[model samples]
Target: MAQAKGNALGALGKLTELRQRIFFVIGALVVFRLGSFIPVPGVNPEAMTRLIQGGGGLLNMFNMFSGGSLQRFSVFALGVVPYISASIVVQMMGSVVPSLQALRKEGEAGRRTMTMYTRFGTVGLSAFQAFGIAAALQSQTAAGGAPVVYTPGFGFILASVVGLTAGSMFLMWLGEQITERGIGNGISLLIFAGIVAGLPGAVSNTLGMASNGELSVLRLIMVVGLVLAVTAFVVFMERAQRRITVNYARRSGGQRAYMNQTSHLPLKINMSGVIPPIFASSLLMFPATAVSWFGAGHQSRWLQGLTQAIAPGQPLYEIVYAVLVIVFAFFYTAIVFNSQETADNLKRSGALIPGIRPGRATGEYIDGVMTRLTGVGAIYLVLVCLVPTFMQNYWHVPFYFGGTSLLIIVVVVMDFTAQVQAHLVSHQYESLLKKANLRRN
Candidate 1:
């Protein structure tokens, strides 16, 4: 009874802490969503609505990422995409640049410096993207022939560039604050929030389509069923891991000898998590986004052809996206989990892999295993991302059905749940320690 009571008390304490964190996250996201509705100066609200409703390729993707900010030509239209892009660039550079690689070895200080650099890069990228968007809006006309921007001039462009850039930076700051004070990764939570915010609208749109005969009931059922299946698959795969056994030699201290300790080094199947898909999506969207700036409504024959080829669900686009996801899966896995470093750390701790030598051979073996795992992981990501594309092409389902958005939603929810559980466990441990001390006293 005492133990059960202790457990209850511990859980209650942890629940209180978890509640605070959850509240902080909710408040931050509420702020973000509110900012998404504040339109940029000179943008015609009605025209913006029509353009968004029409849904061009790049514009749709941007709107999705921005939580519909781009649809309204809001100040936060650029979103945290630039920050994500900057992080990708900085991380990729660490693999190739000797200085960065050395700095990466310096621990927390180096991480702070790298974060500052990423912030600078985010500002620069946001400004560039904001300029492109401003220019594109100037040339863009809705389906009803109304211009998206009422006043297209240098003044409008300058205000947009400043406003959009400031909004993105503020969002970046909010994400950082969430990471420090809230639960889960702040940037990821921001993206997850944005994606999830559209769920209600997606469901409504699907129902409307079904009612209007644009979509059959069977097709809607299939889409919903597929989304549930994909989400389950993602959850299963994310939890899957390969455990490599490690043995630590017995140590002798004074007259007593410690027994050999056995443990396992767990390597997750998807070591790169959602990063590969996010990177691939960003890279694939870049060309289309850039083209939208110069060729909003009017495009040359070649430009038009290129745009079609790279548009979502296009054969060429799918192929490139899959390839990029695979490549980035390997690349990010290598960066995060270095087999040599792992082997070295184990060796230093007097541990060795079962039946493997404690040096180069162990590293090679671990690397080979990781390579195979990453290959499978990459294929899983590609399939998960492409399933929605296929559904959209054939069943004409919306983009949110089963792609990157679904993946992020599943992964983030799993991660957040895990964090909450961890906090609860810690609280329980602390309670047990206190009880033990009280008994001794």
Candidate 2:
């Protein structure tokens, strides 16, 4: 009876901790969503809406990332894109810049320093983007010819730059807090929340179109089926791994010799996770966004051609996007999973692949395996990202159900669920340890 009571109490303690963390994450997301509604000062909401409705190319994508904040011209209109861009820039720099590379090898303190630099980069990027947005808004007019900005001036530009920058920084801080205290990766969860929050509206829009005879029921069914299929595919690919067998030689003490042990190193099929898609999107969107925002009114013929070529549904856009995804998949996979480091660690532990020598040979073996795996992974990412674009273009399906959004949603949920399970397992282990201690006493 006493043991039963102790176990129950321990379970209850774990439940309390898990509940607190889940609540913190939910609260942070709620705050982010609420902020999405608070419009930037001196902006005409109706004009902004009209612009979004008519600006069906990159603006739609921007609004999706912002959780409709861009359509509302909200303070959080920049969303976390600036921070994501900053992080990618910093990470890429780490590979080429000696100082950054040194910092990467410095452990926790070094990581903190890198993070500080990323935050500063986010601020600068957000401010620049915000000023461009303000200038763009000044040049934009609604269908009825009303200015998107009610009072466009230097004051409005300053206020917008400050508001948008502050909002993005606040989101960055919130993401960090979530990472420290919540269930999953804070930045990923934030982007996940933004994307997922728009689902209901997307559903409503599709259904409404169907009701109005604009969309056939068959098409709707097809769209739903495609989304479900893509989601399952993503889950499978994300969980798939290749296991490499390693053998550790026997270790001898003064008295006894231990037998050799065997283990396997598991390399995930998609070692880069959703990073390739995110990075590709950022790179593709930057130029498109800049052209659309800055050159909207005074676009030259070449500028117009460039924008048209890179628009979301265009062939060139799809091709470039696919190529970028593939390249980033290999690049990011290389950065995050260093074959040399893994081989060195295995060697230090007296472990070696059955048919390969330790050190350079092991590294080469791992690298060769990684190269092949990365190629497969890159193709998978490209297909997953581009398939939805084709569906949207040919079938007129909404972009909300696109492959990129679905990938982010599915991956983030998987990660969040895994984190929760990890916490539960850790809690149960602690309870067992405590009970063992009590019995010993």
Candidate 3:
């Protein structure tokens, strides 16, 4: 840890580009937070907060991911949710749609085309969600009977829809900018920032509960320790990999025949990264949020039952959430690393797995290995996701200290630090090459 800190410090002091990227990320996050505080037209932030808190369950989760923007009824209340939902839709389509699937092989042009599709989808989803939210807020009343939306009319709905959609679109663009000009995965970092933004209040709330005997000190300590332990375990698992040995065919040089070389392809234990949790959280939050709107005014029995059934601590919610995380884990891993494609590339490069044949057999062998790895990965995701539900239900831990938030925070931090170190290493290598060339000259 000390060595890592020292290296980070050295990089910051010596690497201009790394320093700039770090500063850029910090600045972008500041902008995100500032936007979170800016309320949309004709909506009462305090009233919205009261209504949201009363709704509880999924709304809290949504607010947490949005950095409290939802409770504030801010322009960014939607956050990058629409964008994430769009990504989920697009990725699922890419798996099924021949044209979208074909784009994956087109390289940079393919990526650009897919990104355009995602952005277009983001706009559409954002507008739909914003319109629903506007209509819902118009009907909502706080505990004291204050309207969440002060002016409930067509004008207000139009304004809210436009404001929220524009905010979502802006955030999508900002995230892309950060990804290009800054550090880390921009969308992941934005989510990380949202989670971290709520930490101070969560800590204070926990302390207040402890002081009031609402939470036992012993239990509080256990929660803290469990969180720390989970974080450490996640770090270990993220770095863990399965290495498969591959042998390269012998090559003929000018006057020498080089022997075959051996290498190992490292497959990450969690190839899906934080994506599965994020995807699951976003998907699960939607139904609850939608059900909530109907329950607010109508009080229908089925709607109420659904609201409770899918509540955060409920058995149904927990089961579905775990299943989604597990499914997305395997699904996303398959999307990210295609075994047949990898095998084909390897074959073209004259490499073969120890006992597997060069083409279809190699692909099958790799797919088998990946299937096992993904199973383990999916189980890990389920545990990490569900443990917090158990803790929040039984142990009374704050939802802010929940599993999804922690996984995202840990994974994003790991990825960001890894990128920073990689940048420093690249810079050093370039410096070394320059020095060697100068010496030769």
Q: Which stretches of candidate 2 lie above 4 Å from their native place? A: 250-258, 282-291, 294-299
Give per-residue CA lDDT, model 3, range 288-361, as digits (tens): 66666665455566666676777777778888888998899888888878899899999999999987889999
Instruction: For residue 131, give model 1's deviation from the true position in Å.
Output: 2.2
Cα error, residue 22 of model 3, in Å, equals 1.3
**Candidate 3 overall Cα lDDT vs. reference?**
0.85
Q: How high is each candidate's TM-score?
A: 0.91, 0.93, 0.91
lDDT of 3 at 104: 75
Give model 2's TM-score versus the native structure.
0.93
* Candidate lDDT (C-alpha), each: 0.85, 0.88, 0.85
RMSD of each: 2.8, 2.1, 4.3
Q: Looking at model 1, how many pairs of residues clash?
A: 0
* Cα lDDT, model 1, residue 50: 79
Residue 177 Cα positional deviation in candidate 2, in Å, after optimal superposition: 1.0
Instruction: Write one digit per residue (lDDT tens) for candidate 1, span 326-416.
Output: 9999989998788998899999999998889989999999999999999999999999999988888866776564477887788888888
Clashing pairs in 1: none
